[model samples]
Target: MQPEDLVRDHTIYACVTGSRAFGLATDDSDTDRRGVYVAPTALFWRFDKPPAHVDGPLPEQFSWELERFCELALRANPNILECLHSPLVEHADATGRELLALREAFLSRRAYESFTGYALGQRRKLDADLRTRGAPRWKHAMHLLRLLISARDLLRTGRLTVDVGAEREGLLAVKRGEVPWPR
Candidate 1:
């Protein structure tokens, strides 16, 4: 089957992600859509398996095959884990509901490392920008802070929450350059 066919006809779970999912969207932000689709089991018997992911039939949209999603989630992939925790769910089928119910199964002590490593990588990029340009990209800096917050909270609570909740105003200040950095 075609890539779009899997996303369109077999998608089991879908959600709004990125800024909107994090409760940090500005009026100009794009709606980022992510989803999981289950290709028929019969298809795997063939040589050319369905795509592990599809980039888009819609702009800023993407999807993963169900097994691949779960595999990454189990590996403590921060993006996959956060996608599973996204609060702006747009669709969930019976299988999707089952997947959501299994969300907590994806968390572990490993998350601390995963989140920290990703944050460190992003931090390095911002740090490079700061060193050469005299200022970090404030928007990326804001996200790194938010990611750190989420990682701390998740490690503390053993649960993941993708939305920033009460951290919104302060984070927005960082994003908008209203807050002084290195304070």
Candidate 2:
């Protein structure tokens, strides 16, 4: 079967991610999609292993094979961990639901490292923009700060929160370039 067929036939989990899932989407924001697919159990018995992942026939669509996904989440890979916790789920089957139920098992103190590392990387890019443009990408700066706060709260509370909650207005103001950054 073709790779897209695998995703179509075997996709076990799917969600809207990025700004949409983060409670930060504006009218023009792209819908970022993410998902995991489990290759049929029979596929592994063959000499050729199933593909580890497939990129979309549709824009903004991407998926991972289940085993590969679990491996990354076990290592506290920020993207994978966030996928499991995304609040904007679009589809999930029994297997996918079981995987979601294991979300906490996949999270550990290791996220203290991974989450902060990811946030710092984004912050660096925003800083670079500030250096060259006399202003940072305020939208990116806002997301970086949001990510840092998420990481801090996760470390302190051992809970993951994908949505910005009551902070939506403040964050959107940043996105509109209304928030000030120190020179």
The top-ranked prediction according to lDDT is: 1
Give model 1's TM-score versus the native structure. 0.94
Candidate 2 matches the true fold with a TM-score of 0.91
Clashes of 1: 0
TM-score of each: 0.94, 0.91
Off by over 4 Å in 2: 45-48
Runs in model 1 deviating more than 4 A are none
Check candidate 1 and list the clashing pairs: none
lDDT of each: 0.91, 0.87
lDDT of 2 by residue, 73-123 (tens): 998887888789999899999999999999999889888888888888888
Question: How does residue 158 of candidate 2 score in lDDT?
Answer: 89
